[model samples]
Structure formats: structure tokens, C-alpha cells
Target: MKYLFGPVPSRRLGHSLGIDLIPFKTCTYDCIYCELGRTTHLKDKPAAYMSAKEIKAELDTFFANHHPPVDFITLGGSGEPTLNANLAQIVEIVKNLNKAPLAVLTNGSLLWREEIVNALLKADVVLPSLDTVFIKTWKKINRPHPLLKLETIINGLKGFRRKYKGQIWLEILFVRGVNDTEVEIEALHRVLEEISPEKIQLNTVVRPPAERGVEPLTKKDLEEIKEKLGPKAEIVVDFKRPIEERAELLNLREEIIALLSRRPCVLEDIVHALGAHINTVIKMMDGLQKENLVDAYLHNGKRYYLIRKGER
Candidate 1:
């Protein structure tokens, strides 16, 4: 399962099967709050980061033995999945193998290129990252590659929206003390107004961030940010309702719990392993805590999730 992992659930994309085409954090930006840590191969353009044939072979092997089906074949993990040169080909192959929709989880860096835009045309969903709308704050928070330009990326987004006939869910992750200023929110609001995505998902560091300085935005702050972002904006999600369970999720909750049993972790680790969402995690943790299977603690100013007595 080199490329295939977890028909894991997600707050945004229900039952998801994640496809990691790029290696660890080989992205266009070194975002401050990335769960997988810093972007190691930071680049502004796309390249042959992984072999398309290899990815397809991996998927062939995965779908052969996997169960249930899937809501979406999500291009995610390690870094910006678009950085993989053969992404378009991979998506084409995936479309042939499954009835589920396909998605690309990106940093919104490469959308400026016409070729990249063409490549993603068949994808059912595109979840692009827009952490900051202002260039200064964008640079400060996302720390994009030297070759990257904010205006160019924005144009790319607009171009993609005009051409692609799929759902575009824009994500804006706020970091306390850095990109969470009132001014920054206003800038992001203006940007959202232009992009006009089907949904604007507001998020924060609910996990151990790549850097110590990065922090989560409070619920109050998130509400304000959502208001400013207008009608399309959605606060931290709550993925509780079941969606006819696509993909094989047998032992998913158990496997996630087993992982947590080893050590205390925030929502990101769970998301990393299970492909679930933070909202789903909040619900799962609450349930586990009620059953005395999990414990909650705070370290420094951040929260830590751990296994409870007898459970560990």
C-alpha cells in the first residue's frame, strides 16, 4: 500500500481513500502549521516527484484487496499532491477503477499553470489551501517558495474555477499571533469574495504544528472570521452524520484507537493515520472519554490527547 492508505473518513470528504503521490512535504510552501511538519522539497513549480505508473500499480493493488468503496479518491498526504508530475495521469487511472469521486488536496500554489489546470479538469473536487490573503501575511505564515507569487496563484485559482466543472472547497487555516489578526481576516475575506468557492472552510492548528509559534484560533475568533468571510464560510466542521459508508472502514475506529493507545496526540495525528477530520476526531474523542477509554491533557498552552487507564 505504498500509495494507498486509509479509506479513512474526513470531515469534508466523508469516506476517503488517500493517495500520497509526493514524498514528505515536497510542496510549494513551507506552511507554519502543516501537520506533516515543514516542507522539505519546497518548490513553486510541478515536477516528476513520483512515478505515475508506480502510483497506478499501487492503486491497482489497493483496490483489489480493499473493501466497501470510497466517497472520494483524495490526492493528499506528506505535501501538496499536485507537486507530483504524473498527477493528471493518476487521476485518469483512478477514475477508471472506482465509482467514487476524485479530489486534490493542494496548497493552491500551482493552479496558475494552464497545464495544471488542464490536469485537474476531471477531478470531482479540489480542496486548495488559502491560509492568508495578504502577501505579507501569506509569506509570514505559509512561507511560500521564493519563486511563488500571490497574484499569479490567485489568477490560477480564478482560471481553474472558470474552466473546471467541479466543487472547489477553499480552506483557510489561521495561526494565532501570526495570521489571525483582524487585518489579515479582512484580507482573507476579500480574497474569498473573489474566489467564490462552493465552501470556505475555516481551520486552525488543532494538532502539534510544525513550528512552536503556530497556534490555533479560538472558536470565538473562528466565528468572527467566518462572519467576515461571508455566507460561503464554514467554521470547524462536525462530520457526524453517516453517508452510507463508502470504502472499507472495518476496524478503522479500533485501529485509530490502537494508534492513540501508544502515545498522546492531537487531532492531526488521528487525521494523519485514519484520513478522518478534526470534527470527526472531536466527536470520537468525546465518545472515548465518556467510556473512559481516552484521557485529555494540556501541555504548554496546547491540548494533548492520550489513552486512559486499562485502555493503554
Candidate 2:
């Protein structure tokens, strides 16, 4: 499980199994709103952070257990995934596994590199973030490497749209009093016209962010912005996960604790695993939260439950 983290719940991709290609906080940009904390290394070059063999071996071990059905095998974790040098080979290996549709969550700063874009071709979906179209805002928000140019990145996305046949779901994370202005939204609209993503996902700071100044936008504001961005834009909402009776309430609580002892998971992931009623699960989670048995944090607009540090 060194490389694989979750068959965790994802609002966009369903029960997503996460693969951490790069080391923790190792990325091209150190954004203010990152939920995983600050980027320790701001890197632009691709290297074999973890060997393709190691990643494949972890995936093999995971699938051998045949845990449950997952909607996507997502390449994302504490850092941007594309920085891993053997991405293309790793994608092929994952494709061969055929456990689920492959997806990658990235900042899209590296898409300018033909190698990076080519490697992503095998993925079923590519979720890339573009917070701002203007360089000053981009620099302030993302704090990318000096080599990373806004113009180059935009052109790269446009180029990727042409070469990539897979679904491109473009994400825009708007922080209040930062990139949420009318002028910025208008600029984003222009970029969207060029990129033509399958879906334009509008997001904001929903978690305890890395910086104190990062503030979330109101749902009302997001709705208005979505309208401005046009028909393709939509807010990423929580999934209505299936709920069915299974074990007794006490047993269900034990199961949840056991699962979270290993890794964090979303409500839907817990529901799908336990087959318990969502209301029952919520009640249990609330009890755990009250008792400090578990904790919750928002990532990508979805609340995730995890065992508190040292509680396990």
C-alpha cells in the first residue's frame, strides 16, 4: 500500500483508488488552498520518483485481494502525478490490470511537454486544474516554478485538447477575494473556449487550507459564476451514495473504524463497503466525530472521514 492509498470515495469519479506517483508535497506549484499542506519541493522536471515496477506491484497486490468495485483508479495523491518519469509505462500497466477506468488529477502545468501529454493518452479521464488565465493571479494562487509560464500552459491545454481523445474535465478553483472577480471569470471563459473541455468543474476552498487567507466562496456566488462560465460549467457536488442494510449498528461502526484505521475514505466509500443506510452511517460518523474517534476534512469539495492521528 506504499503507492496505493484509497479505494476512497470521490464525488466526481465515484469509488476511486488513489495512486501516489510523486512523493508527498512534491509538485510543480505550491498553491495556497492545497489541503495536503505546503509543497516541500517545487519541481518541474520529470523523474522516476517511484519505479514503474513498484507501482505495478502495489496495484497487483491490491487487485489480488479483490476488495470491491471501484469507479476509477486515479493517479493523484500528495503531489502532482505527472512528475513521475515512467508515467506512460505505468498507465499501460494499469490499463492491463483492467480493475477500473484510469483517471489522473493534475495541475496541468506539465501538459506543455509532449511526453507528458502523450503519457496521459491512455487514461479514461484527465482532470486538470486551471485557476486563472492571467499570469499575476496565476502566480499568486499557484506559486508555480519560475520556468512555468501561463501562456505556455494555456497553449499546452489547447494542444492537449487536439491530441487527447479522452474526456477532459477542466477544474477551476476560485478563492474568495483572489481569483473570483468578474474580469478573471471572463478571462477563464476565453480560455475555456480554446480548451473546450467535456466538463468545466467550478470549485473553491472548502477545506482547512494551507494559508489562513484562503477563503471559500458562497454557493450563491458559485451559481452565478457557473452561469457566467456557460453551460458546461457546474459545481462539483457530493454524490448520493447507495445505502442498504447489512450488519448491526455496532458491527457497522467497528467496520468503519477498521477501514479508516488503514486510510481515509468518503461517505460513499463507506456506504458502498458496508451497504448500510446513509442516515445510519451519518449518525455513526457524528458519534465518532463527537468522541474524537474519527475526523473529517474536505478535499475537492467532498468531505472525507479518517481515523485521527494517534487514535489508530
Candidate 3:
């Protein structure tokens, strides 16, 4: 499962099975708030980062082993998925193997290209990021590659909206004092109207970010922004429902608890032992805490998750 990462929980798309198309940290923009840290490749051009055959093999193995109820087979991971040269081919292959909806998560840097837009036509949903509309704010927030122009990216999104018939859930990650300014939000609102996505998911930095300067907005601030963006917008920061059992997540939860029962472990410890994504681990930890099955305590200034004594 080199390319396939998870049937992990998601607040938007439940039980999303993630497929990593590009190599680790390879992307067009080195976003300030990326949880995966800085962009290592900083690539703009599309090339075959991973072979279609390899991805197809993984998909086959995954479905054969566990035909878990997956909401979406998301094409995204450590980097911009569009950069994978054989994106359309991979999508076609996956679609042949599964009935679940297909999705693509991208930074929207390459959407302006006609080829990229056409390639994504088969996706059931496309979630592209839009942090800011202004060039200065875009530069400051995304730190895009030199070849990626702000205007080009905006126009590309607009163009893609016009051409794409699938659901577009445009995401805007605002940092306090960065893109949350009055003028910035106003401009973004106007552009968002032009894009006219099915939904506008507002998000901010939550977990530890790549850069310390990146700050998250409070729920109060997020509510205000959602109001400004109109009825189509909603905050996607938190989840109220429990993770579905259909996601085949019981095993993951059991595994985490077993490791914690032996000894308390940090997020990294669970991830390393299980070879799971950090985001997935965080969500699992949140669910475990909500159920009072696990708790965290600071040890040597680092928080570690542990099984509750009563349960133990």
C-alpha cells in the first residue's frame, strides 16, 4: 500500500480512502499552515510521480482484503495530486475497480491549464484550496512557486468552475491577521461568488502548523466569516458525529488502545507503530477522548495519549 494511505475519517467526506499520487511534500505551493511541513519538491510541471500500474495494484489489494464502505476514494496526499502525470489514467483505473465516488484534493495551482481541467472531469468531487484572492495575500499565505501567478490561479478556478459539472467544495484556510482582514475577506467573497462552488468550507490552522507565524481563528471569528461568505459557506473545523463503523475503523481504534494500554504514546508514536497518517491519528484520538476511552497527559512537556484506568 505504497500509494494508498487510509480509509480514514473526514469531517466532510466520511470514511475517505486516501490515495497519495505524488511523493512526500512535493507540491507547487509551500503553504504556511501545511501540517506535512514545507514543500520539498516545489514542482509546477505535471509528470508521472508514481506509476499508474502501482496505484492500480494497491487499489486491487485494498478492495480484495477489505471492501470497507468508503465515501470517497480521494486522490491526494503528501503533495499536489494534479502533479502526477497519469492522474486521469489512475482515476479511470480506480473507477473501474470501485463504485464509491472519486475525489481530488489540490492546491488549485494547476487548474488554469486545460489539460488539468479535462483530466479531472471524471471526479465526483474536487476540493481545491483558495486561501486568498489578492496577489499580495496569496504570496504571503501560500508562498507559491515562482511560476504560479495569483491571477492565473484565480482565473483557473473560475474557468474550472465553468467547465466542471461535479461538486466543488472550495476550501479557504484563513490565518488570524493574515487573510482574515476585512479587505481580504471582502475580495475573497467576490471571487467566491464567481467560482460558485457547491459548498464553501471555511477552515483555519488547527493542529501545529509548518510555520509558527500561522495562527488559527477562533470559532467566533469563523462564524463571522461564514456569515460574510453567505449561506453557502460553513465552518469545517470540527466534527459532531461519531466516526462510522463502516469505515473499518474499529481495528485502528483497537490497535491504538492496545498500544496506549501498554504505555502512553504521542501522536507520532501511534502513527509510527501503525503506519497511519498524523491527521487520521488526531481524529481517532479526538473520538477516543470524546468516548472517555482515552486521555492525554503531558510528559516531559510532550502530550501523550493513554487508555483510561477504569477501562483498563
Candidate 4:
């Protein structure tokens, strides 16, 4: 369970079983709006940070359990997944398992590399983020590595689209006054047309982000952008469907603490992660707070819960 962290609910992928390939915060971009805090190991090079053997062992152990059904086995967590050198081998391992459809979530920075594109060819679906088309806004929002270029990333996406046969759900996260300008949207619309993803998911900051003052766009704002982006575009909404029961979720305190240690989550996130009722999660939070095991603070109207530092 060191790498596999959820059959957590996802708005796009339903109940996704997440696979963490890269180390925590090891990424190509240190985006201001990232919910998992800042990127600590910012690099563009792909490395064997994790071995295929280790991933295979974890997936085998996970599948051996009688767990709840998951919609997709997603290769993503903590940081950019594409940076893992054993991506193709890991993808093959998952495909061999045949438990569920495999999906790769990436920042689309490394897609310009032919090897990276080839490595992802076996995935059932790929979700890549393209926050902005403009270099200034791209840097402002994504804070990408010095080696990354907007043009290269776009070309990579376009190249991948040409070769890959699977579904591509392209994500564009809008930060108010940063990447939400009229000019950038129009440019993005043009670029998206060329890439031709099956869906264009428009997202804004909903969770507590790495930096302060990073604001989310309103529903009205997103709707207008969706209209401009045309029929393929849809806003990424919160996952509302009830989660299927997992037999092993007996210890709510441990589960909540485990999730929070990875990243601060709202009550809704805890509910989805644990597949527990909202009221149940609320009660658990209250108990944890009283026990001094967890602490919460409000950010942009959302209360985020986290494990108290140095509290085991």
C-alpha cells in the first residue's frame, strides 16, 4: 500500500485506484494552484525513481485483496507520472492484470518526447493538463522547469494525439486573472482544436493550493469558457455518487490520517477517499480534532483537514 492509495472517487474517472510512480512533489512544474503543496524536486528528466518490480509487487498485493470495484487503475499520484522511466513496463503489468481499464494522468510536459509518448500507448485513457497556451501565463500558473517550453509541450500533445488510439481527456485548470483572460482562452481553443481530445475538462482551484491568493473561477465564468471552447468542453464538477463499500475501511481514524499525511483534504475528499457517508466523516473529524490527532483551517470557504505535524 506504499504506492497504491485509493479507489478514491474521481469526477472524471469514477472510483480510480491511484498508482504513485514518482516521489512526493518530484515534478516538472511547481504550479501555484497545486493542492499537494509546492514541488520540492523540480526536474524535467525522466528517471528510474521507482522500479517496475516494486510497482508490480504492490499491484499484485492490492489485487489479491477483496476490495471494492474501481473504475480505472490510474497511473498518477504525488507528482508527474511520466517521469518514471519504467512507465511502459508498469503499464504492461497493469494491462496483464486485466482488473480494470488503465489510465495515465500527466502534466503533458514530457509528451513531446517520442519515448514518453510510446510508453503511454497501451493505456486505455490519458488525462493530461494544458493550463495555458501562452508562455507568460503558462510560467505564471504552472511554474514549469527551465527546460520546458510551451511550444514543445503543445507539439508533444499533438504528436501523441496522432499516434494514440485511446481516449484523451485534456484538462485545463483556470486560475483567476492568471490564465482566464480572453486572449489565452482563444489561443487554447485554437490549440485544442489541433490536438483534438475527446473531452476538454475545465477545472479551477477547489482544494487548498500551495500558494496563497490563488483564486478559483466562478461557475458562471467556467460556463462562458465552456461555451467558447465549444461542444467538447465540460466543467470538472465534484464527484457526488455514493462510493461502494470496502470491507477494510474499519479504522476511519487511520484512513483519514493516512490521506491527510499525503495532502490536506476537505471533508468531501475524506468522504470520497474512505467511501464513508458525509455525516460519518464529519463525526470522525470532530473526534480526531478533539483527540489532537488532526487540525483544520479554512481556505477560500473550504475547511481543509491535515494530520498535526509530528503526531504519529
**lDDT of each candidate versus the true structure:** 0.78, 0.87, 0.87, 0.87
lDDT of 2: 0.87
Per-residue C-alpha lDDT of model 2 across residues 1-312, encoded as one tens digit per residue: 567866877778989988888876889999999866678889988988998999999988888886877899999987889999989999999999987999999999999998999999889999999999999999999999888899999999999999999999999998999999999999899989989999999888776577888988888999999999889999983322222222356688899999999889998889778776454576679779989999999999999999999987
For model 1, the stretches where C-alpha displacement exceeds 4 angstroms are: 237-312
User: What lDDT is reached at residue 21 by model 3?
Assistant: 89
Q: Write the residue-wise lDDT of candidate 3 on 113-217 in tens digits.
A: 877898898899999999998888888889999988889888999999988899999999989999999999899999999999999999888765778878889
> What stretches of model 4 exceed 4 Å from their correct place?
239-312
Q: What TM-score would candidate 4 get against the native?
A: 0.79
TM-score of each: 0.75, 0.77, 0.79, 0.79
- Model 2 Cα displacement at 184 (Å)? 0.3
Name the regions of candidate 2 deviating beyond 4 angstroms: 237-312
Local error of candidate 2 at residue 26 (angstroms): 0.4
lDDT string for model 4 (25-53, tens) is: 88999999987777889998899988889
Worst 10 residues of 1 by lDDT: 239-248
lDDT of residue 125 for candidate 1: 90
lDDT of 1 by residue, 1-312 (tens): 556767876888888888888766688888878766667788877788778788888877776774766888899877788887787788888888866889888888899887788889988899998887678888888889998899898888888888989999998887888888888777777777778899999887775567886767778888987877789889853323222332223356687678887887876778777776443455567667888878889888778888877766
Clash pairs detected, candidate 3: none
Model 1 residue 128 distance off true place after TM-score fit, in angstroms: 0.5
How much does candidate 2 score in TM-score? 0.77
